[model samples]
Target: MKSVDATEFRVGGSDGWTVTTSFNYNQWAEKNRFQVGDSLLFDYDSGKDSVYQVNKEDYDKCHTEKPIETYKDGHTSIKLDETGTLYFISGNCGNCRKNEKMVVQVMACRGSCNSAASLGYLSCLGVVGAFVASLLL
Candidate 1:
């Protein structure tokens, strides 16, 4: 059964993903808690920018030569399918160097939510995801 807890987090909050001196993505990521089954929604202009899932090394160096995964659509929704650290950077190496990257640590599922998610109940996971995100906010 799906629990009504599955959540989709908007990357960079209301500002979305963009190159701005005032927006700090690392700070934004530090404020939130991510878990398996949750989703990350990246909103940006496909024409000019794209999302690239990279390793820690690439993320640190702002290397766009190779990406684990690439998303070019204006809106990209990536599911947190595992528990661990995930790194993301901008396809634009210049923008990434300017600190347009973020690292997400997906915690293991816990409590009843874990069982629900283990059973493939994404709805329940969504609810839990939302609740966790709210607490951090």
Candidate 2:
């Protein structure tokens, strides 16, 4: 097994998660480098706000209903197991209308992340060799 050190992002930064203010989540995400295996920690006031994980279509459309997943414990931790784009929004319609949405891109895992792990990166050389042969033809 490989041990990967993941970063835990606190949604909404020091203010925690909420739509009470004109907080810029997109700005915060732009500064962070997210990768596979990282975790997101959403700390908010459950009584007032809720978290919803939705697909891009739902996120862009601001459809709060039928979320892919829902979290209301206020302190939620989500693991990024794959490299791709993730979309999140406030379950509250008012908040969603206020643009309480966030998107993050998880980067692909780097090779040989741990010193103890052995990688078969060289195994793909056969394909590379085939491509090089085509270039000669």
Candidate 3:
């Protein structure tokens, strides 16, 4: 299980998941630097609001119908397992049309796995494996 104490972000902060204001989300994400090991927690009323993971094009278009993934449990946790551009929007059409969306640039973890390795990216487990292999040799 990923540690809740670690790099996790509560979407919308003190106001929870509801769009207090577009500026709230904008300011919340401004100072945050997301990494592969981090996660996002969305807390809201599922009936009126939903979270949609989408692509840039879809996000820009506010196309909430077809999403890369959908979460509507009110409290959702999405782990960042890869590094790239990640886009999320409100699945509720009106809320989305009003521009309730977020774009995050997920970056690779910088500490243990910072390298141009053959397989490209490695998780913390890979770092451990490398350490173990060194010990064996």
Candidate 4:
């Protein structure tokens, strides 16, 4: 079972999921760390936009027809059940082409992260883990 202490991220930060070509989802994704218990919240306009979880090939090509998973409710929350890379792109190919895609790398929970008192502590551990990984690399 997933941990109830998981952290939920608002995709694209304050800007949210939209066709704003200026926003860089990839960059935003890189700024944070994802764990197995983490979740992503995609907020957008259901009438005009949608979210699609696709493979790396489809994400790069902006191919929406063969999405691995589709979310069109305007507000989508997807949980990270395991550790690995997950790719997501906009349903609107045009928007996707304009940089509306993100590649998330989820890492396994280390130490006592799940038992942390505050969710913020989990995030702190993630940052520390990244630092440790970078040093090893």
TM-score of each: 0.80, 0.76, 0.76, 0.77
User: Model 3 has how many clashing residue pairs?
Assistant: 0
Residue-level lDDT tens digits of model 2 in 65-89: 7898999998999988788888999
lDDT by residue for model 1 (5-72), tens: 65799998887888988999888888888877789999999998999999999998999988999999
User: What is the alpha-carbon lDDT for the whole of candidate 3?
Assistant: 0.77
Candidate 2: worst 10 consecutive residues by lDDT? Answer: 114-123
lDDT of 3 by residue, 30-82 (tens): 67988876899999898899999998899989897679999999999998888
- For each candidate, how many residue pairs have backbone atoms clashing (under 3 Å)? 12, 0, 0, 0
lDDT to native, each model: 0.84, 0.79, 0.77, 0.84
| Candidate with better TM-score, 1 vs 3 | 1
* Candidate 1 ranges beyond 4 A from true positions: 1-4, 114-137
Residue 137 miss distance in model 1 (angstroms): 33
Residue 131's lDDT in candidate 2: 58
- In model 4, which runs have C-alpha deviations exceeding 4 angstroms? 1-4, 113-137
